[model samples]
Target: MIGFARTVRLWFDPREIRQEGVTPDYRFSLANERTFLAWLRTALALIGGGFAVDQFLPGLRWGWRVGLALALLAAGVVCSLRAVNHWVRCERAMRRGEDLPVSRFPALLSLAVAVVAVAMVVVVLVGWEG
Candidate 1:
């Protein structure tokens, strides 16, 4: 059971993230894992938010409803995908004693959420029927 659980964890986690840059300090590796988990949490929140909007907000027009749901879902997927890649890259950099990688996804995600929030406000205030 323990082995199976470990396997499942490895499947989701970047456990092998240190393959390229072995022997980095445990603290660095743990930090990398924490960062990866943070990204995963963000992805999960985005996905959950999408689901909540789709299920609970029935007042929205079909076009707007579906668009918002898809946007959130896509953002979630993007964040998850980027998380793994970023984890691997950062781990490798750490192993090589290089600087941490610059993260573009956070900025992109913040911008996306901001745009969606603004659009939602407009829809609510203006009664956007389409």
Candidate 2:
């Protein structure tokens, strides 16, 4: 059983794998992985914030909840798709010995956050009056 467990662990261990040669662009690959993970975290945060808004603003109208859910789901989907595309672009750049593709994530995320803020303000105003 111990031997079996060790074999299973070895299968999942990154150090156990050996590449035939040094990748000319290992730095780009590592950076790409980091960027992908960052986008994934952003996507998760958007989804979580959507649920939180619904929970915290129970008095909010159905329209507001729907809008929040749609916005967050859209943001998550966009981020996930962008991450995959960015990874592919980085890999291609590395293979061709070109500079890695630049990221527009910061700007895009900022816009999404702004939309969320506006939506929150609208919700608060409507809730107060109703």
Candidate 3:
């Protein structure tokens, strides 16, 4: 409970997090920032892919089309949110000289993308008549 409160506070108040631990080497912080940016780029790609799926696949069945687009969009939203929270967590850990936090997000995200891909293949091969 207390941990959640602190995370919430850190979410809104980044300055407090920065003040909590001694400043680490600038290179590590920059690396973390780069990673955050990479996640943002991935999130953007997911979001764009969602829009593309919706706009480009006019022939796909309505239900399947919407489902795919919504899935991608939801993944994008989750990824973007996770990116920020992860950035905060990592930054704090780095400042405190603790090991970087580990997460299963990458594996989960990969699984999601694989599922979406398989769905796309099935829709394409079996044919979705709209």
RMSD to the hidden true structure, all candidates: 6.8, 9.2, 1.3
Model 2 ranges off by over 4 Å: 1-22, 103-105
Per-candidate total of colliding backbone pairs? 0, 0, 0
Clashing pairs for model 2 are: none
Whole-model Cα lDDT of every candidate shown, in order: 0.80, 0.72, 0.91
Clashing pairs in 3: none
> Higher-lDDT candidate among 1 and 2?
1
Q: Which candidate is the best by lDDT?
A: 3
- List, residue by residue over 1-130, the lDDT tens digit for candidate 2: 9954644554456453232223555676788789789888988888888788777777777787778877887888888766766665565556666777787787978987897889788778877445
Between 2 and 3, whose lDDT is larger? 3
Error of 3 at 83 (Å): 0.3
* Residue 75 of model 3, lDDT score: 97
Candidate 3 residue spans exceeding 4 A from truth: none
Better of 1 and 3 by lDDT: 3
Candidate 1 wrong stretches, greater than 4 Å = 1-21, 128-130
lDDT of 1 by residue, 68-98 (tens): 8888999999999778778777766787788
lDDT of 2 at 85: 61
